[model samples]
Target chain A: MTAWRLIDSGILRAAEHFALNRALLEARRQGGPSTLRFLRFAPSALLGYHQSAEQELRLDACTELGIDIQRRISGGGAIFMDETQFGWELYLDRADLGTRDMSIIARRICEAAARAVSGFGIDARFRPRNDIEVGGRKISGTGGVFDGDALLYQGTLLVEFDVEKMLRILRVPAEKLSGKAIADARDRVASLAELLGFAPPLDEVKARLEQAFGAEFGVTFQPGTPSEGELELYRAALPEIDSPAWINLVGKPRSDLPILEAAKKFPGGLLRAALAFDRPGERIRQAWFTGDMFVNPRRTIADLEAALKNAAGADVAGIVRDFFSTRDCDMLTLTPDDFIMVVHQAMAQAGPERTRP
Target chain B: MTSIGDCLFPDELFYNVDTGIWARREADGTITVGMTSCACSMVGELVAYLPKKVGEHVERNKSLATVESGKWVGPVKAPVGGEIIAVNGAVAAKAAIINADPYGRGWVAKMKPANWDGEAAGLITGAGVRAAFEAKMKADGLSRC
Candidate 1:
């Protein structure tokens, strides 16, 4: 089998990383080599291509902390990256994947990635949509961008994460930024350092990932650098990706997605649901639950939240009922309908008359 | 509603099989463009859509819009490019419309065709859609829609 080139681009700024994203994608589309690249970023807050900075991040906080803000070519939620985070990406033609379906492409890459992470002696699995998880807690999050037949899928692995620092810069309500809430975030996110008791050598980590991906796609990897053509494309796309106009291209006010909460006393415990509602779309943009509920396998809440993300408001009851019907888990004395009740009560607050001034 | 399995290929619309888009020449002489049902099934339910601004001139095979599904972003290539006169605000707000109604109410953009007679002739339509879509599905490795 012919060896594929593997390039490890050292730590750089956010603007430089995204510029490379554009350059590499366009170059590959123009018939350049399909390669695997590893990259790291200095402190930065990157937004999904169609996301608004105002709705996703604290702009003043980002500036005060000196985190470079930029937009990714991919679609997903916003993220905060620093040197502690490692990023890996695959640039390949759609034909090489044996399918033109984007969802299948993302799944195949993520499953291969999960295999790589499992090499660390953790039980890592690819969660639906785009998350690589261990025991239900996310260790890696993924997204992608494509041009013509060429596509780039990328994922981030947490070497050592600072949950508090992340929550500080994220646009959660200030009151919700309590020490306990930050501690709660740790249950939903995992890091290699915490899981393995030490940060593995960077060389070994990269090599293992390359090996796993190679095994999955039946290709060997060889070290190489970017061609001159790709560099020229990078230079051209840089000014655009790093500009404010690009970062703010999809601007929306914070009010567009408002957080609403409802609390109820169930037979088992007091359950509470706070969700971000998209009034126009009539969907729950995201939902978070916190309470003294006795749900074994703590990852259940996060997984439920993931399933409920972007769910229609009217369909919340059926979704909740349907979600629990399939999963083999214990919710103590609390039925899935208990979750439905709280979620509906909260969405009721988003009614037109209630929001109108 | 003519279909190849669950995917629709309305006889009245012209299709660019390679691009997976449809072009409808409206009575006012403007061309309405949208993704074919095959394109919709491939992407799944879209989460976001960003179309070219109204009044922007685009070239053939260039991007008229981009859609995101499950965090994957890709373009909807223009079949016969011209100035984008209007975009569907409904689809912009709710992208599921494309999957639910790919032919109507989910049209991406409306543009005055640059060369209707010339380009429209190249597109497969009418009685030829079934065979064209059958070969396309076979190449795509899709047994069902």
Candidate 2:
């Protein structure tokens, strides 16, 4: 059996880390070995490949906090990455997964990653599309990129989290950065320290992941470093990845994505919906929920938000209906229609205005 | 028109069988490019399309545009490289239009080919289209579009 390779690229600047992302994925695309790599970034705000910096991040805040701003080779939402968290990625051929369906591939990889997180004695599970959550609160978020037959799937593990710090860096659609919002953010996201009562050692964390992935792929990992050829590619890619031009590849005006808000008090609690509406596309680019909601499992709101990102306006009701029907969740007395109605109220500016309930 | 399962391939348009994109040689000389129905099904629904600026020249098989769906983002390569002349504003406004109508209003970009007479040979069309896509679907482990 051919052995898989493993490499550790400890904390580096955002640009350097991304350059390695480019170099290694390129190597894998050109017939390099299937490998797993561990990485971390010194405080940075990274944008997904298709995102516009102006639309996703608060530039003034990122600049003031000495946070490096760059874009991922992969696509997803903008994220705040810092040394406090850890990252893991896998490079493999499609044959390894035995499927080419994008959503299925994502789900399978997340399931394995969830197993890795589960090894830490917390009940972590895969949430469809691309997230690993612990009881509805997200612990890891992932995305993928493919070049030829080689694909790279990567995700972040929140070892230590500061909701306020994240709120400062991101123009989150869910709610404005406020003391109450921070509390809600905590409800939706948590750190390894918060979940386990202490941060697990970095080596133990890596070993747990290695064991999970090794079992999933039915192969053992032999420690290795970037080949010289990969280093050369990394050097060449650094200049472009570190420049201003790369960051502006998908520039869009913030006005194009405006947050539309709606709130309602149900028997369960007051649930607020803040949708970052895409004006021209008539899509909800993202929806954030914040209010005195009393869902048994707090992660329901986060999962619902994930379900509705870039969702079509007309499909909101059906999507919510489908979501509730398929998922096992107890939102006190709140129903899916309550969620749909609030979203419709938020979309009033683009469509027929609904009277406040 | 020829179809493999639910994917439709018009006898008139040419395809880059490797990349799953189609190119149409417009009467006016510019080429219209878009994803095939099978390609659309593979990615589910498109949420965004960012095309290269009009007038920007691209090499053969290079990215003419970036498309995102299901949070998985990647490129739609040019079948025959040339300068982008126009892009579909409607599809940009609502990307699901591409899912709704892949061959018509969803045409991704219009390009002025650099050497259509030469590069056109690289694309498959006519009777060959069906076999090419059939092989592709099998290789991709896809049951249907």
Candidate 3:
């Protein structure tokens, strides 16, 4: 069996972490050893590779909280993370995964990660696209980047997450800050502490992940550190990655991305939705629910919002209906159609057509 | 046009099958580039596109543009070293057009090759285009367009 090097890069600032991302990916492309690295970050808000910090994060809130803001090399939505979450990343050649198709590569890595998380006695499963969830609540989110023949796949394990803090740190619709909204947010995301009644030891978490990946790829891991070559590359890369030019590489106007909203009184209760619609993309970037709707397992609303994120304008109704049909919910005096209607109403507020003219 | 499965590879265009991008030498001595139909099929509906700015110099095998779909982002590499002269504004505004009409309005960028004679040999065309793409699809484990 092949032996892969393992590196534990304890706690680092977000800039250093991102700089390492560039260095390690370059190293892999130049035929460096395959590696499994465990990492943790101080308080930070990370933007996707092609995201604008001004558009995705609340700068004042992040500054007041003393959270460092950085951009990831991988592509995905922005996320607020702190020491409470542990990060796992793999650096390997494309051939090592035996696939070049991005979706298939994501599935194989996520399935192994899901197995590792489930080893903690929680029923975790790999959700399509890129997420690991327990009982419909997401516990981990993943993304990746590639350079020529080299690839870097990374994910975060929520050891003890603060859903309310994340909602506040991001530039979500203002209504999402309410007490009830926090409760709804809590329902959609799961943490190790919330699920197991206590946080699992970091060592235990890493061991399970190491074993799972080893078995999945038929390789044993040997403890190691960054190679001399990688260290040289890291020195060369830090100057560029540790600068604002890299962080603001893809800045876009916030006005182009607006939080559109709509509300209506139904027989069940008052129903309302706030949608972060990306006009140029003609997609609902995210959806949030508010108001006095009494539904069993309130988490259903959050789950519905998760399902609606990035949904094309024409497909919202179908996706919403599909979501309700697959899950059991007790909504008093309110039908699934009502939720779909309110969401459409919110989207309509954006304009007559969601598509570009 | 040459057909490989459901994908179409116009016999006249030059292709870098490994990169899954095609180039057409325009009458004005410039080259128009776009993702092949096979590439569009492999990546589902595109949600975002970020092309390199016009007037920028891009080396061969370097990213000319970045596109995202289903939360996965990948680059469309340049087939030859060149200076980007223009980008497809229509496709930039609505990336789904790249999937709907890849070879037409969805052309990605136009460039003036720095050394066309030096790089032309690297791209495949004519009778060999179909076979090259078929082998690439098989190696990628792609079933059909």
The CA lDDT of each predicted structure is: 0.85, 0.86, 0.86
Off by more than 4 A, model 1 = A172-175, A353-357, B141-145
List, residue by residue over A1-357, the lDDT tens digit for candidate 3.
899999999999988888888899889988998999999999999998877888899888899889888888888789989999999999988779766667888889999999999999999988767888888788999988876668888999999998888987988765457887677677678999999999999999999999999999999999998888888888898888889888888888887678889899999999888888887777888788878989877767767877887788788889988998998889989888898898888877777555547
Model 2's number of clashes is 2
Q: Which pairs of residues clash in candidate 1, taking residues 3 or more apart in a chain or in different chains?
A: none
In model 1 chain A, the worst 10-residue window by lDDT is A348-357
Number of the predicted model whose TM-score against the real structure is largest? 1
CAPRI band for model 2: medium
User: What is candidate 3's DockQ?
Assistant: 0.52
For candidate 3, report its TM-score: 0.93
Shift of residue B20 alpha carbon in model 3, Å? 1.2
Comparing 2 and 3 on DockQ, the stronger one = 2
Q: Rank the candidates by TM-score, best first.
A: 1, 2, 3
Candidate 1 lands at a TM-score of: 0.96
- List runs of model 3 lying over 4 Å from the truth: A174-176, A291-300, A325-333, A352-356, B138-145
lDDT of 2 by residue, A147-176 (tens): 656788999999998789899998887446
